[model samples]
Target chain A: MQADQSALQCNACGGLCYFSPERSALECLSCGECYDLGQPDDYLARDEFAHRPDVAEPEDNITPAQRTHQCQNCGGEVLFTGPALSAHCPYCNGPVVLVSGDAGYRTMALIPFRVDAAFAKRLAQKWAASRVACPAGLADVVAQGDVAGLYAPFWTFDSDEVVQYWANFVKPGGKAIRISSTKGQMKIAFDDMLMPASPHVTPLIRDGILHDFDPRDLKPYRAGYLAGFAAERHHQTVAEGIAANSADKDLLIRNHIKYKIDRTGVHGIRYLTDTSGIHYRRILLPVWILHYSYGGHAYKIAVSGIDGRTFGERPFARRRLALYSAAISACVIALGMAIGAAAAF
Target chain B: MLAETSPLFAAAALFGLSTYFGLIPIHKLIQMHEARHELRQGSASRLRRAGGWVVVALWLLTVMWCAVFIGDWWASGDYQAASERAWQRIGILAKLAASAGGVR
Candidate 1:
């Protein structure tokens, strides 16, 4: 339980992950074994991700990120804040990242955050207090836990890819499975597709962070954003983040292509990967990460301002089932009576 | 339903009164059910296109009904008379209501 007080190395994965969730004993995402968040290192170490987590990662239909441009050389994603032309793709073990978009060449537009560390601290505190349900360390979770505000490393990309897609669709009766494909050549110019430099923050989550931010008011990456914070460095490479965001970009491609084709149903997509090069913009996005303590345990959730989007799980409210069932029964009865009257008439 | 009721506030009111008096308990029961989530098994996406069309139709009809009201006012007796008393009075009322953001 003392390990819950301060940061400790995980015996399983050597990750600096906090023993969070209040309800569950410390379940190492990297190791997949649940332990006392209090005594996480007693168990010997082993790989946990042999199989994917039972819960599937949510799809990008929620919110997606924005990047500045496309990479021309290796078609790997790019996110350069300063004047850098190219970078290496850690994935394919090749140097393929290239800057080849308008935002890449010119130091154009930006809108930095007006909120300072004091404000962000207050915000984080308020956020932490709201999660009084979590057991991280009810009083000390937000009070003592490292709440420094540093500009976390990020790579923002913006690009417009002319995507083409073909999908299979069946009629109402499934009489014939016809292919309704589209070859759309439209420009989807967006500003901030942020991928967190830290491994702790998954590309999936960071991409969502950027997507949630309103593009209409994005300030250029500024140093002041780092004013008073502890920041995480990038452990996951741009290649990995690209792989994460690619799922979404492909979906965008599908939708744009579908718009061109103009149809409804789709059975499966033959994901034609990497059609367009991506432009890059390294940026800092504001997030209020809160640590909470419930019953002798800790939990955290990131509150995004880009939109009021939250990512974390608190157990379902106990009374929810009863309330839901009552509501459903009442509605069903009313609907039935109305239908019966209509039938009689 | 504006297109259907713009000219007959009286009829719309009558219907509204009838529904209220006749289905009061039924409606309450429906509300109760909705609060407790008695909805049939369907995701939001499933409900969207089906419900969206109903909303679209309702909006269109309402707008059309308002257009009828304007047409009737324009063709009234005062507008066609040598002394424009009735038409002018209505025009003044329309102007005042417009200024108040009530008519428009």
Candidate 2:
């Protein structure tokens, strides 16, 4: 026996309602009724030590991308890979919300899909056609691929970093001249440093999915937003995601310091950095993802649900590459021969 | 003396120096452009591409300037003469500075 899974039902006609990206409202599929979600409250909780009772801490040793969900409609086993949110049961086609987390993992905040499925499909077609090495038949191949709209789990960190740095600037001429050493302190404040909280999602994929997202677009978590779309719950703790990006953040801070002080000749620089007043919030961002096979190889492309920004690995035409390489090599060899002849003379 | 006057050697040195100092930023710009391109942010990608080209053009111009300087030295055969003139000018400027400062 599985817990009852419920979806948004239209009050007018008893039809299923889905969150429409274009309308930014819920639309009934049967009666074509539109319901506005109105404004979502901006509630950002900032207690680093606070823990939600419903949220379970990740295991000390962690490895799991699969979750089992028993569909309430048909009692069929629904296998969810990664942090996927919503799917239809194969047995009954009933919409099933695969909650991978405990009650604590309920909706916190989300960036709803601004680009709808139709727009996503059109963008996919346009992107495939514009690809440089795309086969002539790639359009047909892409047309058959399934595109799923889902919200990926992310941890947005806000903090202020203060760094104490020391650097030795060499004299204009050389070390033989008087050397000047300087020490200074710098403070950098950043908000919404969003990192993918799902272990399977990388920064690259997240950027591909939500290019230049405005944090203002984040809405208070509502079950209605997850009505039509699949949502993934965060697997990695906020600390873990921050730890994953700590080295890069350090490098960024160092570069920023260098940019400020390394104007002339910098001999060496050393710095110590501390991030304070750290706060974080969990949110889900929309992405349109498709994995398709072409020429016996699989390819994946993701489009930002907020914007139409697309990113993916595109295949190159081997035949065209070989021809270009041959031509370039021939020209290079001829040029070398002509240069050698002139040198001999 | 020949190496000093040859534009090729000077150009090579300029290229090396420019490359050593500029390659990292150029690589970063190109990477930024590519990342923007991947995300289909056409305007942003174009901006990055233009910035990357500006850096390349600046490096090229620096190398060209060095080559032109070397060419002038070789063509005029006045490398030593130019150095002597520069030293004389510096001496005159220093004397003027001393006089203005009432330092005899």
The candidate that wins on TM-score is 2
lDDT of 1 by residue, B34-85 (tens): 3223222221211221233322223223332332333343334122331233
Question: Where does candidate 2 clash, by residue pair?
Answer: A54-A104, A85-A231, A86-A230
CA-lDDT, candidates in order = 0.36, 0.58
lDDT of 1 by residue, A143-189 (tens): 55332222344556555454434455433324233344433344555
> How high is the lDDT of residue B8 in model 2?
48
RMSD of 2: 11.7
Best DockQ among the predictions, by candidate number: 2
State the iRMSD of every prediction, in order shown.
18.9, 15.2
Cα lDDT of model 2 by residue, B1-104, tens digit: 54454544644555455445554444444345556466423222323333444444444334333444444444455666533443444444434332332110
- Worst ten in a row by lDDT for model 2 chain A: A44-53
**For each predicted model, how many residue pairs clash, with residues at least 3 apart or on different chains?**
48, 3
Q: Supply DockQ values for each candidate.
A: 0.02, 0.05
Give TM-scores of the second chain, every candidate: 0.28, 0.44
- Distance from true location, Cα of A149 in model 2, Å: 0.5
